[model samples]
Target: MTRLYSQPPRIDAGLFFLRFTGCLLLLHVHGLPKIFHFSEELTHIEDPFGLGPWVSLLSAIVAEVICPLFILVGAFTRLACLPIIAVLLVAMLFVHPDWSIAEGQFGWLLLIIFTTLAIAGPGRWRVGASQSREVRYGAG
Candidate 1:
């Protein structure tokens, strides 16, 4: 029998899966609930930061629904990350400044993750893969 080394695969597939799952989980756990549950509250509350409730609602919808959809499909992943990053920044500065580490840490983690996604962009298997290649090749 051929000698089979004991080492695991070298491709880091688990890392890719973890990143994708983490993005989806974050959007579902944090963003989706807030979007669905807080719609009325978001509409009525006077935004203290001068963004106003309508703008806040729009931002939340974009971040929670639109961005999460894109992230799940890995379509326009970098573009989708922008709204999430903005939302996290707002949350960090306005909403949870005094919260405990567990409560507040997600914003920071999202910031880092989204920022990285924005920089590196969606990987090879994303919905945008063809578009990415087209852009690189200057095709229509």
Candidate 2:
């Protein structure tokens, strides 16, 4: 019996798509709005860490914006995912505790994707620091 396709490459591509799509949407759709409204939200945002609203706002911006951008580029992808995951978790539990499963579906999906990337490693495509660590297996 012969398989129809090489599995590893397909799996790697799927992982890349998952990582890129999640991070890109979160960065532009969510993070950018927060950043652009930082001053207005600073005193009003939730502070789950007891660090005050301004600090929380900044931390959230870093997690949602900076960290996701790093993950999108595959630079320290695993490490970058940690902050993103943390932000999502806090949002799930505290900021939006009333969020129904349907409403929080995307958040849950991102949590799973980030967790997967954290474990599966950042696949074969990358730039900057992680480029050296990426390994490709070609059937020669």
lDDT of each: 0.68, 0.82
Q: Which residue pairs show backbone clashes in model 2?
A: none
Candidate 2 structure quality by residue, lDDT tens digits, 1-140: 33233336677688789889988888887799898888887868888778888779888899889988888878898898898889889999988999999999989888898888888767766664333344446554
Candidate 1's TM-score:
0.68
> Once superposed on the true structure, which residue ranges of model 2 sit more than 4 Å away at CA?
1-7, 128-140
lDDT of 1 by residue, 1-140 (tens): 34333323332243346448757867687667766777665757436478788887777777867786777667777788888888877788776677877887767777887787777665655553452232222233
**Model 1, stretches more than 4 Å misplaced?**
1-19, 38-40, 43-48, 100-102, 128-140
Q: Each candidate's TM vs. the true structure?
A: 0.68, 0.80
TM-score of 2: 0.80
